[model samples]
Target: MKKTAYQKELAIKATQKREGTDNNKRDVMKIQSWLTLFSMRNPDSGTATGIDGDFGPATERAVKNFQSFNSLTKTGIVDQELFDKLSSNLKEAFEKPLVGNNLRSLMIEVAENHLKQHPFELEIQGQSNSGPWVRSYMDGHDGSPWFWCMGFAQTILDQASSAIDKNFKALMPLTYSCDTVGNTGLEKGLLSRYQKIRRDPSLLKQGDIFLIQKSRLDWTHTGVIIAVEGDVIETVEGNTNHQGSRNGVAVMKRTRSLRRSKIDVFSIEPLV
Candidate 1:
């Protein structure tokens, strides 16, 4: 997709906003945001250090305390797992439309929230004696009976819709098979499906589905489109790796510059 001049300018501005912030300021805001969301998810966990947006001594102490309690590395830096957990809680809280905030920021927040809530075991394939390459986040449960990337993608969409009280039934579902040899293999059938959706713009909206083909020519990843700025589509995806780790969502420009097998789009409709 070709980016318009205005879109390019917006992208540049977005990048600059992120990069212009001082590292300390950025980390402080991030930590505060994480703590706020965490508190929402686990009220029993106690109140957050507050959204001071400054990584001062108090914030550092609080992070260390959290890490110690969670039995995570007490380095005081918010790692991926901690970040994801916090994000999940925040997403549940802000599941509705945010009235006064930047859309890009909200999209990032929603993506992080969805990633934190999505369990990793759900990405694994069929019955196996041992777990898949990824660690299971679900407590006391063995690996899931089966794994479906499309279902995982749908879960994000459902959660996003619920947060905003929006009717997501308008978007249609794109089914995929877990079996490696089946017609649903990521590259074979998934790519074709995405192409079909992209070719038809009328079907797509703010939160549609897009399947990106990773290595091995299969539809190895799935994401929900949060915002479309000209040619670039901001997305949230799951199961890009064998590890059940929620690859924190990203906002990459839709350009040929990035190397990938193919991109599939699915226009979902509201359920009648």
Candidate 2:
């Protein structure tokens, strides 16, 4: 019997080291492992060019060809998108059901906890902009002014992941850009894509992240779906006050028509 991705024990953790343009060991290892498994998805996807832990020409060509076939830009760079695309099945194969509270419920708890503090917009004040609650996702600028909607979401996951047993980080990329998260879903199978998943809001559960698709290449804003009523979606968003802007002024909860928003939904399976 072949050793499964689960047996490898590495298929669960999201690759943290993304050296986009650097020739590093972690990137090489991640790409090699993904291509080794995902190449088997289709003959043209790419052959297992040996897991020698090298991001050489063979791996680059394989990635580019895979991207071209998948309708992604043939950048030939093994970025987050490429890694997620190649590991969709592998990720699914290793995904275990949440032992207790699902990631959604736990994430909501974290979000609500922050709401308790009534964190508001500070515009230029680094203190309020970089509150202690949302500081974990601030990268290095813990107490500095910065846009924080992404940080809010990621921070929720950070706290929730520790509380529950879900692979929140794996399912949701720990990034500040909603578009990048949406793109990763395209291949990693996070998107509630019509083909693989029903596009019905009725199917959307609480704790799901939705992106406001501004264009083919960009997602302007994001929020956590707290509830869904028919075509209306209630969300908890950060960095905004009212009249939703990409750069909102504070954290607020709001509801809107899903159709008007042109939203893209992403989810992970095995939620308890």
Candidate 3:
């Protein structure tokens, strides 16, 4: 079916709103994904190659096609107007539940249970006049190494798999190293792993492991998926000392709009 005038206008608005971001490439990928979902509903709206979370030729073409068909400038760029239209159309699609499988939710529950079984002391780092250091458990001695983010995320993924009586080898393998920071195993960038996951949400489950990028340029953080609600994703991360809080886990609610802030998600499924 042909797209209605109202739908075209909405897409234009959404595209316009997506402009001017430090992570323009990531944003473009998200726009493409949203566009793909939109096209799934109004099959004649235009074709999107799907959200690979990367800005490539296919995505550029889709943007231009969408703009031209909507009577908007064919700049091949997504702006607020286009984004708004896409958002409106997607909202309508979401009203119809696709299919709800609880595998992801089940993974989250298992992860939580595992954490309870092997809870450990969480140490907070403090800035000293010389350099950064952790408060010693006994003082007057070198503090212990703080729990690394990758290890923390991996433990949850591993434990969740075990709780469900699944073989760990069958699940996605996770590896962490200092050199991997700012790299997603795809290219050189801080927190590249998380960016890869964000680009492909279809591969993620509720309890998947994720590495959260600390900043647009610095991919130095990690986290886990606590929940997924349509376009909104909730994450539980460690080492963000915010709101007068010390070393512990913190929850962040993110929307599809924040593209530069990437998260690497590793999905796991049980063997039948």
Candidate 4:
């Protein structure tokens, strides 16, 4: 399977940052962000570094510590070799090869690939919905108002579509807003309202998109349905945590009760 173009560019940009001289702030920030994310994921990797875009003594020390933890030379430099190790999680999620017989199964496969990477949101300098994963999914956009559940859902679809040599944008526009996706589903006659789905849960197939309906015309969150059993649906979703709030953080595999919250399904049979 071909890697997503956004991550390829991000990987290139990350490798461009060589140490020793005054590094670009944005590049440095990327390095620091990755370091912080790595530390957050692996507590023993190194001390948590700040994403201040400064390659100062603290950042250098953190790099050295990270290198030491990874059993590498403590060079304290963010070189191509070092970046490959630092950003491996991102690469695995967006670049790893996957296979499936069709779009529906392929989307489930793609979503699982990302869930393995444990993507999550970061608050950088008091900015929410901010991080490398969010940026990649949002097409280099992240922050407040960049709620990325829809972006994550679309990215999974995009990767699956690319793998199958199909255009996912034709099924649903590449967007970050849940309302846009829900609206498009309604317009395309792909939306299965909660009322109808409650009566016939079979209408929701694995790999179908789920929109958290706020009312007749608004959706607040989105995710991919991975399984359906009676009133419960298993989902691979982004920007949510244990409580399952729409604004929570992390890429999670969650089980939601269909009878509890209002949800609408967007069928992907059109793509299949």
Candidate 5:
């Protein structure tokens, strides 16, 4: 099976040494970022390396250590095979075939699969949101500007839609901005505003998306509603943490009270 676009980019970059030459600095940064992500995901990989976009001795040592630990020849280089091992975790999470009777179940399953991989954003070269996971979800674009909660939610929707032979973009624009999503929801008549949802919690179902409203026309964050129980809804949101900040570092499960925050629900009922 083919990997995601970011993985293809990494595979291409992995072919070259990317050894801190002025022209190859960005490529080196990507490789180092993937290595760091792999290490963080698999603590035993021993491939922990700083992402400074310079393939120095420390980077080589990390590559060799990972290779040795994984039973590959200790070449101290990041070849295609080595890169494959490094990215296998994400490939498994994203490419695995899912089975579900409906779009809601499929979306929930897709989000859960990603959660299982422990996707976390990284800061490379002093730039936040520059990481393998962020790139994968954000269409190979990652930086401080790419707050990826909407991107992550859209990705999950796309994955489940693909399984069901549906088009996700028809439901919501492919975007990283919560404002764009909330606007699209309003236009499609699929948006349930905070007041309406507060009165009827059942309007928000599992697999629906929740947008954190900042103002009448502004939404700051979004996530997949995995379960709705009474006044507390459990969500699998990206770019958030235990504190549920919109500018968070990882994909996390959080519980939000319906009465506590100004939230809107984007229903998938139209799709079903």
Candidate 6:
């Protein structure tokens, strides 16, 4: 992130200070933003430091964890060395190339992480019906109690791809409907579905999006294909529960066989 004029002025002062020093609030906030970004892109970076620009214990913990990951001393200080490494890592991720299974792997990585944030739900007003997690997939639309399986899938794809600076919408259309994925994938020549009455499940790979037709007009349910077994496939699905209904409760990892008659697979480009 390019620093603002004020932030640049503060940065000069903050650079000379250590953990115990009382740095400028804006400087600390800038560091907080970097800390949050670092954790957002790394799967094992522990809890993200909020970008509130406050130098709190949470920020220190995040700094320590980041330093530990980069093999730097865990002084919990936002020094020049730590800032340099953070800048370098962010640059690398921004410049990271999305090729072959990289996108798929990143999608799977995101799915696995969200799986741990289970019991995720919706709220009416200030309750569970709406929140940041719910709003994420809704694409800034109010996250009411609408069916959100496709929203979940598309949101994760967008976030995971952007983490490495890939254009997820360019790779796959971002829509709240599963049919969009199928249509876009087919139009882009990235979709694969065997013409036979019963297609082989082995043809599906991790990171493929599965669409289950709910009616003649649209495919209603969706999930991310995590792995393909001999006859069945593993999945991480949203708006689903133990029974795997379209209007299910939360995200869950499921194992089920291919219902070729009722399913279509959308494989990302260069993956099929």
Report every candidate's CA lDDT. Answer: 0.41, 0.59, 0.44, 0.84, 0.82, 0.63
Report the C-alpha lDDT of model 6 over 183-212, residue by residue, as the tens digit.
787688776654431455566778878887
Clash count list over all predictions: 21, 3, 36, 0, 0, 6
Superior by lDDT: candidate 2 or candidate 3:
2
Model 6: residues >4 Å from true position, as ranges? Answer: 1-101, 125-129, 143-145, 194-197, 215-217
In candidate 6, list every pair of residues with a backbone clash: 29-53, 122-128, 122-129, 123-128, 123-129, 123-130
User: What lDDT tens digits, residue by residue, belong to model 3 across residues 152-177?
Assistant: 45444444444445554454334443
lDDT value, candidate 4, whole model? 0.84
Tell me how many residue pairs clash in candidate 4.
Answer: 0
Location of the lowest summed lDDT over 10 successive residues in candidate 6? 1-10
Off by over 4 Å in 3: 1-103, 114-144, 169-203, 214-218, 241-260, 269-272
lDDT of 4 by residue, 1-272 (tens): 22253563255344333354557777777778888887878898775788888788888988888888888888787777788888888888887888697998988998999999889788888899998888888888889888889888989888888887888888877778889888999999999999999999989899999999999999999999999999999999999989887888899999999999898999988779
By lDDT rank, best first, the candidates go 4, 5, 6, 2, 3, 1
Model 5 regions more than 4 Å off? 1-4, 7-10, 13-26, 42-45
TM-score of 5: 0.91
TM-scores of all models?
Answer: 0.37, 0.55, 0.38, 0.94, 0.91, 0.57
* Deviation in Å, model 2, residue 263 alpha carbon: 0.9
Error of 2 at 2 (Å): 32
Q: How many clashing residue pairs are found in candidate 2?
A: 3
In candidate 3, position 213 carries an lDDT of 51
* Candidate order by decreasing TM-score: 4, 5, 6, 2, 3, 1
